[model samples]
Target: MDDFDMLGAPQGSAGNGIGADEDPAAAFLAQQESEIAGIENDEGFSILDSGEVPSSLIQDPDDANSRKQEVEWKEKAKLELEEWHTRQNEQLEKTKVNNRAAEEAMVSELDENSPGTEWERVARLCDFNPKSSKQAKDVSRMRSVLISLKQAPLVR
Candidate 1:
């Protein structure tokens, strides 16, 4: 009358009640064991093994040429780095000198005690009104003088 009773065991046989088809856990374990066995016997598994470089390619312990080349490259790199540093230091010194000269030129153009002769002459040209009249005329005159100086091209 029950579902288990429909599939009867052999007559007079003492069955373990739980059949092989009904046990999913045992079937899974058997499948896993078969897969593990297959993997263990596989020929491609040797490819997973680590390979080392041949001894011939490695630097010879007694060879001087390899050592000499290494030392030469290191010396070359050191010399190039030193030259770069020297050039940077020279550039920095040149910049400092140029900045110092510019500062000196600006200082010489200014008069602490009294206005310079050029300033007084330019001021007189525009009736001493530096902001409006004098500045405009002075700017034009200064531009002309700068142009002429450039045209003449100082022997630097």
Candidate 2:
């Protein structure tokens, strides 16, 4: 008996009688042509898909406009950064000027009220021009407090 597959088909021969050694491309082409020749008059088929081109497939090999735009955007970004730096420097200079003025005022104030001169400044701050009877009484009380403090001896 001839050799046969489990399905009773002859061994080394496909069900179509094509041998394994036969060129698959030629066999496939012959099968397709036979199928097409066997076709009777019938309605054609139509297909529909989402129709969107995938990003990977939608590539331009030479897109100079995009590169030009990128270069322009970079230049504008750099200019904006430079302007920000200039503004920051101006703000820093203004702050430094303000700080220097404040320090000078504080130094002059300290110099004017330093050591023995502090008592004169304190006396001027305490002096009051009394107009009413109540004001005069308050001033009198202040003078007594000052005199008592002045008479007190300093402990070594």
Candidate 3:
């Protein structure tokens, strides 16, 4: 009937209260026992003694189906994202090819070492209309700079 024994304390020296009614160990055991008794009387309290679970605790069938559908939707969305990325990469590659072809065409049309004056060659390569007032000024400035560079003496 000792409170310490109810708490599974060792039956020997320690189990016996040190001759005091106000022992802390005894008080703790009394509290635990009262709580356990209260829970046992509750109608909703239960112990799953058997290995099998009761149907009440099982998940609803609709929830399981919804989860399965959600997983499938996520998988479909992931595949769509991957396909979009692949298409974007293909378009980027096509653009690069087109740019390279355009550059090659321009270079073939006019070689940098072709026989012409420096101004003529530069103006033609840049597609500059020397007739335009703004372009004429730019071309004149470029011609002067080029002429000065060409006439400058080699410093050795």
Candidate 4:
């Protein structure tokens, strides 16, 4: 009995009967082809090219546009921030100028109030209105004179 008959298959029936080879590798290949053919004939079965991308993997046009818009928004925001910082610096400079002017004005007023004569300053310190009173009769002037002589009034 042939080897094929011992396996309960007729000779050359182990693979496709069309020029089938006795080699096991060829038989496996033929079996695979037949199985694939059967699958293709079944309902809702189709073969696809391995090189082609699936629909889910393809990039959508709307997604690309949204990404571009996001980049533009970030750029706009950065520009606005820079402009705001520039305006703030300008305002700070103006404030500094105003403050410096006010300080100078105060210094000038203090200089104007300071007496040109030391005697007049001493009279003011002794509570006499040097600019409004008669110098000869002023009691503060006498006190100023005594202080200048190092004989300041004794406090009792």
Candidate 5:
């Protein structure tokens, strides 16, 4: 009435029930009033409650400093992304060079005419991974294979 006390009363109160002991119609009316009051109180909810502008919206309107900081953050992010891409490209190029040299050396090892390059024979004699770089164990096995192949007499 005078205040929105009854109008804003919570739902399911003395007015919102069809129970034999309670009044369903009063309950529904009270619920509707409460909802209407809530809508009116909510900022910018409807054009019905005059110009009761909300205070929160007026408090921190997007100021110049906020906009400037936002732009600065975006620029910083963009530069960081560019630097990341550049570093990624450099690493990729380095890997390509390393792989190319490794492939060439592997091919040479496979070629029979290439002297002292016996990776293919070593790979065949020992169940070793072809991609394993020139490690001590593989080299040791390769020397043994070379020695055995050289010393073994022709048994045709």
Candidate 6:
């Protein structure tokens, strides 16, 4: 028999030789065969029929949750960094206050001939020199002021 004969409709009434009211098994097989033929003719069958599960099916493909978590973590980290910087600034301010107090104490110990003379000495030690003769005059004037203040009578 021809190849078509094997797949031909049941033998009695139709143009294709298959009859109406065919056996359920035969009908099922024919339906399956037709589906196979349709797939063979379709160009996209290979792509559509790939056996692998799509990534979208396995997990939530949208990154909304992950992105939100990242933003939250960044905000938390930023807050922590800001707090650390604030603490560092406070410590720097405290150090500045202490340094100022020490400088005042050292200046007070100098002889009355020059009040800020010790500051000038410190500046010289650090390799900086007064810019002009006027600066030296200012220093002497400041010294006189400090001496006069020291000599003033104390009041309760």
Best by TM-score: 5
TM-score of each: 0.34, 0.36, 0.38, 0.37, 0.47, 0.34
lDDT of 1 by residue, 1-156 (tens): 534575675334237665545666888899999999999998642433457454554556667888899999999999999999999999999999999999997677564435234434343344323355643536666655545554454443
Q: Whose TM-score is higher: candidate 4's or candidate 6's? A: 4
Residue 76 displacement in candidate 5 (angstroms): 0.6
Predicted candidate 6 versus true structure: per-residue lDDT over 70-93, tens digit per residue: 999999999999999999999999
Ranking of models by TM-score:
5, 3, 4, 2, 6, 1
Candidate 2: C-alpha lDDT: 0.69
Which regions of candidate 3 deviate over 4 angstroms? 1-54, 109-112, 120-156
Predict model 1's lDDT versus the native: 0.65
Which candidate, 1 or 2, has the higher lDDT?
Answer: 2
* Global lDDT scores for all candidate models: 0.65, 0.69, 0.70, 0.69, 0.69, 0.68
**Candidate 6 local Cα displacement, residue 85, angstroms:** 1.7
Q: What RMSD value applies to candidate 4? A: 25.4
Query: Can you write out model 4's per-residue Cα lDDT over 1-156, one digit (the tens) per residue?
Result: 466466565455545655434667888999999999998789442334665565545667689899999999999999999999999999999999999999998777557654344444444456534566665665766665646644343334
What is the C-alpha local distance difference test score of candidate 3? 0.70
lDDT of 5 by residue, 1-156 (tens): 534566564544344444445666888999999999988788554433566556665566667689999999999999999999999999999999999999998887566666543544654566435566765444656656655765563354
* All-Cα superposition RMSD per candidate: 17.0, 22.0, 15.2, 25.4, 13.2, 24.3
